[model samples]
Target chain A: MVSITSSRLVRGREARRAAPALERPGVAWAIPGLVFFILFAIVPMAGVVYLSLTRWDGLSTPQFTGLHNWWRFFSDGQILQSTLVTAVLLVGNILVQAPISILLGVWSAGYQRNRAVLSTIFFFPLLLSTAATAVMWRQLLDPNFGIPPKLADLLGGNTDLLGGQKGAIACLIVVTSWQFIPFHTLIYQGAARAIPLTLYQAAAIDGAGRVRQFFHITLPQLRNSIITSTTFMVVGGLTAFDIVLLLTNGGPGTDTSILPFAMYQTAFRTYDYGYASVIASFLLLLATGASLLLVKISGYDKMTSTMEGL
Target chain B: MRRRRNVVAGFAAFAWLLVIGVPLYALVNTAIQPESKYTDGGPVSIPSAVTLDNFRTVIHSGFLHYVWNTVLVAALTVAIVLLLGVPISYAVVRGRGWMTRGVFRLFLLGLAVPSQAVIIPLFLLINRLGLYDSLWGIALPTAAFALPVSVLVLSGGMRDISASLYEAMALDGARPARILVNLVIPLSRSSIATTCVFTALQAWNGFLFPLIMTQSNDTKLVPLGLYNFVSQYGGNVPALLAAVLMSAVPILIVYLFARRALVMGLMGAGGK
Candidate 1:
């Protein structure tokens, strides 16, 4: 029996060795994709950096301005306010959306029953276009004829949830979180489901309660996913554009203007392309820095051993 | 204890239902209600009078044309992404040495650069290429953006194909092209489907590119159309909601059919 097994293994090796040799495919196959990547992504990214150093409107030839745009970006009051608003949104996402999504994810994972229905309901908002979501919320929050104001009136408080400056940022955060919580929840759900059943069983056998088991096992296990989702949310919140643009147009007097909206207004609405590029570059650095920090915290090595496909 | 836990879980689920269901209910309910009812009744009130007149008004005002433009752009983007992403992923999977790894890393860099940061330059490039205000302009960049994730997912799919299968095909003297067609393409169907849905979603929902690159009415996509509709008819809530619902239906149908694959793909990418 040993001889037979050895002979079979030897024969398999021989067959593999005797296979017809074809030249291994080369990097030329990646050329077409790389061409498109270079033109559409790489060159354009480089152009933003270049444009930040030059003064150019859409119609005229660009003039080199030697860091004037950068200086202006640092000192500009409106840009600074937009940055503050973006920071608030990021904090709100981390504080509100992250914990809620994690709770929902863990709950659904543990419960098992109705998990499908629950996840479907939560993920429904992710399917809608940001523009559609913005429009839906805009109508729903209209002060004169909307639900929030009406509900507030019924409760004996008079306020404009979306139309007033003080409430606009909070409203933006709520709408943004409403739209994105599902995405984070899905990520957390994936992580929660991946926890070994044996771990939970062992904890249960040790007389640990459900909450104790979750605190001991689930939260630690979910660290990576939480970090990943936080990165997505932070970067997303900082660069939020469409919803803010459509919902308020950075409105109630620029109170809801995040960085991307500010950048858009600078470029398209005001035709200040150079200054817009400065904001764009700043945002790019901020997103890249935040992502790198999270990735490091999560210990995500890009060339993972699994990628070697051994 | 178990019964109490069940009650809590049930309550949590119910709370979630109300949270998500109410907004969706508002969307559909507002869409179907007559304009007068929308104006007169509270925003959350159930409509006494239901009508498709708002939808008819939206359709007559060339909403369908914008939908078609968006569909065309999305289809073309998916086509281009599949055409380019598949071969590139296969090559990245099979090719030896550092160059292939370098190329893969190059594509991965695309994920870090948001479209907003680069739209100004993209606008300039599109204008320079004389493709500005064309569907191709939107489709091309959107496809470019989609390629990294597509390639990542496809390569992950390709990696799952056993080494023995490749060896057997090679022993049969099958060329690389045949192996790609017969082996890679057939095996990677799920990945391709996932990539297609993802790319389609990106293109269909894309606002920034269409907003910046295209100027003509002929080039208007659905999101832009919705934006313009709101700006032009700010008072007509029902008509606006009707338009939103109309635009959301096709994607909702796609999601209903492919929710599992879509969710799995997104989760996988996000986790990675």
Candidate 2:
């Protein structure tokens, strides 16, 4: 025990001496970046909370209102409706995109020429900004001139795609899915490629057929990718406003208004900066909670910084 | 049985292909067709007459200016992300202090904080700094939002450098900067490339910030330009589609030219 202690101490001293070459960078190295991030990001996050307690329009001073906005948010039926729609959109997007991307991702991992060619086309949507894509889809969904009239059979003869609550929400989901599936598929593709041939060979030797092999092996191997992709979908779904603003603009009497859109309209359009900050605060809580859950579930906190410290 | 399964898979894949391809085809088909003939053929029809007038119209009516603005925003965002992200990532990777660790955690938490949530305070902050309508307004906040992913990607990369390489550089009396330049930078080229592509794309594709912050034509980004176009060219659907197609052209150019490197960089974001 004494010898072990002495050896450990000696090794520790050697490690300290050796590590200085790289570890010599002090906290000063991170300060510039940290300051920039804090000023722009962290400061604004804190400001949202402080501003939530005040009643301020753009021109006037932010007079302290003492939880007036929060009270309103809890009581307001519109906000309750917005929260439900937000949850609906979030679940809708994940359900629609997750399975399709996984199947596409696994298939596209093949070395087949057709798969490669098709996937290259699949990536085209990622190039367009959400704004651009949303703009294009808006035109496509036009009741008079767009594809809705042409494909009335496929869409249940609903010419007015944006006229009703369910139809408008469906359009949002369809457009969002089309735009984001390629990105998630790329994630799954990368993960699928990293999966070993040996595992498949072993599964085949066990007489596991193609479908069984996929369910037993490929699905299990894609665990991390599924989590990563779903995290993106959830986070993205929660703050989804650009597409909402461009496509629906919370039309049909706020039937499609999600939380972020509600925040945007309240702040910018109505000029209610205080109540907007309340919605903003709630968004912050949900987003931060999501990221916290992601970190905890994915062991992401253990993944990077913990690699440094003793 | 195997042949039947392949057929089923092929049919499903083809159906998906149509779902993706039809919209893209419509985008191009409408853009090329004369506006007068757009409704006659609907979206999926073959054009009676192809025209480039829409593209010309888009360029003349300040689309180029918006594109140029977007280019500048992307450049500034990439520069700030690299300049700040590299050293911060290095510190997070190598520094032993709790401060560095805390900063890393701060960024990690930043990963999911959507820029949409903070627009109220951000608008206020930008206004106070008198950068409200400027391109700097967009780039600064954009760079800040992008830094989380940039640092995450870069640090994940910087950690993979072998200790021996650093030790070797240090043995020659090299400091951290020189060692970074000689050892870490060279070794981290792929990740740096990934960072550049990812950061530039985020800045390029950024919408909410540019929308709330800048309203004038002088600072209009392509995405916002596209948004405003919806109302202005709302009647002229073909011209609007042309502009949307034009917005994607630059990225499409990169995809065509540096397909492999671009894809690898793209994959870098996902696997993380």
Candidate 3:
């Protein structure tokens, strides 16, 4: 039996070694994309890094600013404020939105007929472009001409939802969460569907309640999926642009400007390319760091091992 | 056993439906209502009257040109992404060496680095290239930006094809190009379609790129066109909604047809 197992392992190794040699060239399959990314993406990023160090109004020649932009960025209260707002949005989206989606997804995944209906409705926001959705919701949230106050009045008192200082920020989060929940639900449902039913049966046999089973079996098993979904939300929130652009334009007097919009305002609105590049670099650092952290948190070993089939 | 679960799931799903369905109802309802009602808007319970009047007004307002311009850009963006993206993905997937892997990682970096961060340098790059105010100008940057994900998807799809199939064709003394055309192309149709839908939607709904990169109506895409409308006559609620509706139609049509793939594709594309 030992000899037979050893012989089979040797044969597997031999087959793997021979396979590529017998295979047609794979070089063509991979070079064009590699070259394209190197030229456009890598080179451009280098250019951005270089530009971040200089003072250029974009049309004129760049002058070396020698960390002036960086200094200004670090010192600026507005930048710090925008950073905080961005963090708030990111955290809020992940914290508030993720659990709701998990609940909804688990619910949706349990039944076929209901799954179809729920998915269709939940994904409508995903269909609407950010501009249209924002405009639509902007109207819905209008103080004088919107639904929130009217809905509130109908319930016996009037209150404005969009006019509060933090209300707009909350509204932005709500919209983003609404649009994003369907995608998270879909992803989680996919993960949940992949979980074995025998595990559930065993839990039932052990007389575990639904809540206990969910905590023990579902949540632990869904760590990778949850981390991935939350990472997208975090990165997405950090780069939040259009919805904020369309809904409030970072307004109620610049209360909603995240790092991305701040980068926009610095560049096009302010026409300070150098300063904008600095902001861009900061955003780049933040996004890259967050992504790397997510990869780590999601457990790289498990992902890499399982990623072969995925 | 399944029956009990289905009952509870069915109710939960219905609740989910109401959440997304209601807002959309409100939006479509607001568009058809009269201007006074829109401005005096409260809870928009129902449409007071049906009118193509708002749609007519939007079309007559010369947004037709804007609509045309946007379509032109999106089409060009898709065309460019496919043209360049397919070959690039082919190389990244089948090519040899650490350099290939390194270059692929650079594209991954693009996913993390949002376009807003680079808006300053990107605008400079576009202007200096003398692409300012040209449809190609918007198309080029959009395509360049979109390359990472397109290549990612295509390469992932390509990786799924069996090596033996390519080998069989090669043994027949088929050229490399022939093998890719016959095997890789056919095998990657679903992924390619998904990528195309994605690139088109991104280009269609792209705002900041067009806003900074293009100055006038000549190169303006739909998002820019809509933004311009809002800046101009945002107070004209019905007209704005009508224009918004017009701008959304093409994408909505595409979305309606490909909702499943589009939704799943977006999740997959972003998940990585």
Candidate 4:
């Protein structure tokens, strides 16, 4: 009993919908990527776990010594300290970077005239590798010639930034934020643009001020992007190696030495592949567990734009 | 209300600009200055003498060769990611049953795995393959790590193609391959670009792989080269900063010429 006027429209849609089975690729199409990914990614994941149980140098075959490295890893005071430092760096980075990225992301999403120019300037940091950013800051953090001495009083006369644990950690966060905020901001910018202007206009009519509109409207609208950006931050923070290596070298008697650095120092410097693999295994678990937690909590796996229902 | 809000936002933006700009300004200002004068004025002061000597020093130190190796790695990485990521994404989007869905989940799981965590085993694997100290060794694992993101972004793009478009192609008797060639690829152009840009950046800017898998100067990528520069130059701040700037040149050129495409590609990684 379709209306006569809509009969043609219905028929056309029906004609198109009936062709679902056409051009469906088989499971074989996925084999190449699967094989490659498994060979490189999955195999290594399993290998790290296996290596944790073995004693081996780079030059020799691994000897199976069940849970010996694990036992040592737990007892090791440095590992605990490194774990604490890693946690602090991770939390500090998020605290510093997330709000800055969200604010900049929202601000840059405006249709104002200078947004594009400012964005391009902001995009400069992303162009530089973490190595370069760290190196440049290393020079700038130099007590005599860098910004530290010039602003010695503001820093409470602590010009030796990389010397103290707290200062070193602060420097690491600032550097990490500087290098990475632009990327997350870009993510938020895209999400912010997808938000409807009508929502704001409607809120205005309800006597909501701009700040209220942002709190009630823009913040809620950016929920998914917030999750996405924070997820990246977590994964990146867990495996943070380069900046730590370049900027601090896990210095001041390994006080700033996070897990990855400790693992590298064990494997390459001390040639203790077995213990290194223990740290590696711990890193693998932490990274995957944290990401899984974030995904589960944020419902990020069910990724849809905030505007999906609208 | 609008005016006042704009004022606050503007002031914040200005302050942020300085935060971003000052470091960059310091980087450039220091790079052009001769090493002797760098400490006299410190990082903030205008250079007493602007010279290309720092850049010259970088070039002479085999910057171009390292750049070439990096380019090779970036190219190989982009090629591998696209060749593998596109088909799998297509299969994930259109193919039926549990296998494809599981594969998608595997990649989602992989999004958590970082290259550093796997480097020890990756080192052993690369050694077992007899590819240690080779560019191929670095490129292979780098591509592998980038695959999850590649698949995620590409599949996101492929899903946007209206079912009607696929049906139209099917109605025209197009097989899966032909439909992929004729319809899917064209529609997925932006995603492919995103994949290309992202993977290229991953490879180009990669550090840990090259650090562990390849040690020799011949195989050293740019970031690794920069690592060496820190030791070799030894407090030659101007020369070191110049090298850092050089490491960014190729991608910076891409960023300058193809900014919109590069930006859109980065935005695509937002997984919307």
B213 in model 4: Cα distance from truth in Å?
A: 0.7
lDDT for model 1 comes to 0.83
i-RMSD values for every candidate model? 2.3, 2.5, 3.1, 2.1
DockQ score for model 3: 0.39
DockQ category of candidate 1: medium
Least well predicted 10-residue stretch by lDDT in candidate 3 chain A? A298-307
TM-score of each: 0.92, 0.94, 0.89, 0.94
Better of 1 and 3 by DockQ: 1
| Better by lDDT, candidate 4 or 1 | 4
CA lDDT of A92 in candidate 3? 85
Residue pairs clashing, model 4? none
Model 1: per-residue Cα lDDT at residue A41: 88
- Regions of candidate 1 where Cα sits further than 4 Å from its true position: A1-22, A110-113, A153-156, A294-310, B1-4, B265-268
lDDT (tens digit, per residue) of candidate 2 on A41-146: 9999999999999999889899999988899999999999999999999999999999999999999888778889888888888888899899999989898888
Residue-wise lDDT of candidate 1 within A1-310, one digit each (tens)? 9966886686567569755455456788888988888989899889999999999988989999989999988889998899888898889768989888998887766555577667777888887889999999998887778777667857357557766766788888788888888888888887898888889788878888867977899999998888889888877887789988998889888998899999999999999999999999998888878866864676532644344643
Candidate 3's residue-wise lDDT over A1-310, tens digit each? 9966886686568558765354434555545545554555556676778888899886679999888888998999999889899888888889878998887777666657646665666766776667767777777777667767656756355456555558888899888887788778877887787778899889888888778988999998888788888888878887889888888888878788888888888877777888888888888888888877764675531212223666
User: Looking at the true structure's interface, with contacts defined as alpha carbon pairs within 8 Å between chains A and B, what fraction does model 3 recover?
Assistant: 0.52
- Report the error of model 1 at residue A85, Å: 0.9
Assess each model's interface with DockQ, reporting 2 decimals per model.
0.57, 0.58, 0.39, 0.62
For residues B118-199, write the lDDT of model 2, one tens digit per residue: 8999999999999999999999999999899888888898887777777877676566777778888888897898888887
Model 4 misplaced regions, further than 4 Å: A1-23, A297-310, B1-5
